[model samples]
Target: MEPATPLMNDETETLSRMTPVEAFLATPASNVRSETPQDPEHQYLWRCFPDHVWSQRVRDTSSWVWDFGYDIQNLNGSRRWVCKRCIQNKSPRPRSFAEKGIQNANAHLFKGHGIWAPAEATKSAAQRKAEKMKTKDQRSIADVMKLDTRLPREQEIANSLVKSFDRKHFQRLLLEWIIEENHSFSICEQGRLRQIFEYLNPLVKITDASITRKTIRHRILSAYESHKGKVIAALKQSSGLIHVSFDGWKSGNRHSLYGIACFFRDENSQPRKLVLGVPELRTRHFGHNIAAEILDVLDAYGIQDRIGYFTLDNTESNNKAMEVIGGELGFVGSTRRGRCFGHTLNLSAKALLFGHNVEAFEEQRSDQLTYLLRSIQRSEFEMSSDPRIKARKPLDLIIDNDTRWLSQLYMIRRALTLRPFVEQLVLKHRQQWEQDNRSRRTGNLRKSAKEPQICLEENQLTTNDWDVLDHLARLLGFYEDAVKTLEGDGQQRRRKRGWVGSYGNVWEVIQGFEFLLEVLEDYKKLASEIPDAEHFRININLGWEKLNKYYSRLDETPIYYTALALHPAFRWGYFENEWKDNAEWVTKAKQMVREVWEREYRHLQIVRNSVADEPVAKRQRKYYNPFQAYCERTRTVSGCIVVGGWGQ
Candidate 1:
């Protein structure tokens, strides 16, 4: 049931007429934030409404409305009113935001929650809906679009998306939509798309030229020209060195594309991660070849001079390509290279799942799985004990791909879950084979000699194999948390290409690698002594060897060391204590930081207001003596400096 529209009184009318800014300036600041920085009572709100910014000022200074509402900053750098009581009651998305002023919020509170407020003149949701419908009916789509309905510096793009009847804009938009949606370019020149455009605006006539290879080339060039200038300008204005991350991608149509991305800080000191290009790679996927292609993209973006470190998966070709690129860009390639820790972890997991020859083992497992699935579903056998369930039930066995290792783990986990049915099917096939052989020996054969047996030991998973898989799954599960921590979900910022942050840093890579090494080494040694786990020993060692290899390779780049030393939580002291057992190791690490500092950051300087800096003390003036009152409790004592998990 809809609530009645509130009658607007003189007070509510005046509040509605006040500008959003004026209303905000009139609101009083809340002392709660300074007193309790954590704001424990409303901590969960952060998770529930990540898009909302908690404001200091409570709204409606004239009444008790301060307890019911909050003022927050919007994306456009303005104040918005949000109902506090409604959110407190666990409403996931309360319709309480008042963009223009506090009028709508007050009305919502009175209409929905029966809260007292100056909402007499404010309209209800239903009333607003009715007004919107009336206006929508009276206006045409083109006229509605023509209205200045843009957001802060954002509305023009929406209007520019379609020019009401501009054929060029329509065609360009059509081309972009098709490619982005993975639709073939041929869709653009097709009659269906053209027919839709004609429906939208009969004044527009889409060109009916058949989309060929040549037509695709022309349209793509047009699209690039439209977007290339903005990308170049952004790269130039970037405040930090533009780091590059490139990898190969295979599209749905079986075309190979080089995915190139840039990571840096924008002019506003905000992180920016942007994809420069995904051009088709026509040449062989060799290291030098990949290097040439990447350089082409950097050249197009004009960011070669601004190149920083490279982050990539554990691909051997990538290392070689980096060397080539580093030489061209004037740096030691290996020093500039940093392996993607996520990919490295994935490979290590693969080693544990599949023995030494990972690819060969993976192939056999997949092929045997298909055979097992088919043999069970055949008319001759049943997948379950209840025969009425039907053997032709659709079963999907996911095959892992080269790019994603999680898919591989998913495949193994799924196989383990279906092991019961698999075991039953395999046993049934074996029993049938044995019975057939016995009949033939007794001169009472059930079938012709030409018939082949269905049972094959190679295709069946042994009890031992299942045990190995279970252990591996348990072992790798611990790494999942580490992966999530590093995979910061800041993709939205990157897509906007304006500011990038929350992503993993190179500083944690060495520490993570070292931790995993300790874990793997301990596991291998501990399990080697267990008599029942002999097979486990081989695979565990294989995985450990792979991880250790990459861990050592991290030595080639000082960037990882530099990143670690720069972190206040884990500075040079971290290395000294961590490598205390090996004095030479700590000495060599010190030299690496020194070299990086001299080569890159030696001349950098910062101006500081040293005089204004003061000793930390109680935030509020009401608090007494602070440290001065406790002077009698303290005495001068000699102590060693403790830093970065280290002490004398």
Candidate 2:
């Protein structure tokens, strides 16, 4: 049964004669009051009774009143005063006065006047029943009336959102929502979403026009066109050179998508990057077609000539695209296509690890290991019934794919971790195979047990092989760091395009190639020193050949040496120290760098007479520009020593 309203009042008063406060405090007790409740504790109503009349301030009647009865005094002070009836019934959401004292009581009296007012002053039972019967639309109108009854900031934000719910804003919001949350367009038509929106904000109505899947698609198309126009406009206005990258990949649905992104520094030198578009390839992705698509995009932005770099993977298709575009752009020679350093490192590592094979040898062993593990699981299940005998989990072997060598690295690492376990597993399989053969000879096993046993010959891992695997894992760890540092997540290309940073610049590659050769040679020497090297013939010379091929190509690219010479830290002196054995190559490198200054940058020079009124020390300022000073020579008198520096 519903609990009785203990403090119900029958007094009646007109709104004009008395306020809600007066009517609320003047309420009388319930008609069927408990006759045994004659004590002061039971009769006390903190909201209605004066504090002074009940007890002294020193005795802390406020604490007793908050606890509903004065029998027990709280050691810790109390703030909110629970309703006497609510406390008695043990309501989870008990009505309580605020910590600020009587302000909450006044608010309660005003807001709850519909139910708390005297019998005659309150709404009639018929009127109350009519309120409960109101439709959702009618209730929504009532909720709209209370929109401005919130905190200032909250109310302002809500009002702004409602006002800005125009077609464009709605389209942009819907597009972002769908893409970011990976939700389908059909979600707009779903009932649960509409219900949730209504429950969250009754005043805001989500109409069919705003939520229909067809309308959402149309809006997305229009928004895309609008955004594309803006991007084109910005690119046309930009003065800085723009670098672009394009890559094609198949999605989960088998759609061929080609994504292109542009990077450049803004007018203030702040880095900025934006995706041009990810257009789907409906037609065949031929070299000419890809070139045409890329040119169309660059031409649309009017930034074809301002293109700084084309960061693409070293693929024949992409190379053809570069060749076709290069003819039109007047960019000749081997430097037309800026090969992605990350991709180059990936290819080099793959060549080193798996030379001619399409897939790594480790992958085949991994498959065999996986199959044997499954067989072991079936064999061990019957013995796993005992709680103490914990079932062994099947080992997860990593697949070594050709494209990503990092997966190969992780596979080798996992192999090292499971080396001991795998060795024991292989031994067990061999013994079980022998035992099955003996049982079959005796003709004691069932026909089902005559299944083909796992051949351990395919799994070519032994204790000796573990040492080689360990070496490979340790060696690949360096390349893994290089790839991560160069590629950086591939999201922030503008920031990662710095010269001296780990982002793998053309100049850094020259140094890295030299360093990598030394590392490989050192490993080769170490391998020769290992005992039983003949048994484990780990040939790393193939890696050296591949690395040297790329290093030789670096000689054809002058920018690499030019960049190294330009850096203040590593000038001609650094090469002298680093490449002492190859003095002729160093001389050729310096000559090529000097030719760059003479060929393209000679027009920037300004001649000055040094004998004017300056002192010997200060005269060095005449040829202060390093590029000019380094390239030009000074003719000093034969008798006098060349007192000043090279510039003087």
Best candidate, TM-score-wise?
1
lDDT of 1 at 467: 77
RMSD of model 1 against the true structure: 23.8
In terms of lDDT, model 2 sits at 0.57
- Can you write out model 1's per-residue Cα lDDT over 1-648, one digit (the tens) per residue? 124234346535645643332232223224133324444335545555557675644444543344456656655556666666445444557555644656666566545553433334445565456446745645434354454554643366445544545544555666667777977765665678666765666434322212333345445765677989998888788876889889897888787888998888878667768888886765678899999889988987888888989988877889889989998999999998888878988888788767677767534344554666666655434545766656455354567777664566777677676677667666765665557666645756555533332355565667777876776666675455456556666553543333445687677677666666666677787776555787688778888888888888878988887777666556666666567698887667767777887898768776453464655543332312222222212212332243433232
**Model 2, range 1-648, lDDT digits (tens) per residue?**
224355313223432334332333334334232435433324433323334122223444332123232222123443344454443323334466634453344334334322233334344454345345643435422245455535787577666755654544544575689878978777876888767765654533532123555445545655677788788777766655688889999876577888989877665444567888776665688877788778767776778888766778767788678777877776652554566665666666666677656354543454555776666655665467775444555556666765574677888898786666566667776666557666555755554554333443644665556787788787777666555544644343333223222233445556566656766787888788766654323446766776777677666557678777665445565566567889887878877777766754567657553465733342233432322232222222232221222112
User: What are the clash counts of all predictions, listed in order?
Assistant: 7, 0
- Tell me how candidate 1 scores on lDDT: 0.63
The Cα error of candidate 1 at residue 445, in Å, is: 6.1
Question: TM-scores across all candidates?
Answer: 0.59, 0.57
Residue runs of model 1 more than 4 Å from their true location after superposition: 1-173, 187-217, 249-256, 362-395, 428-454, 462-464, 492-500, 525-531, 607-648
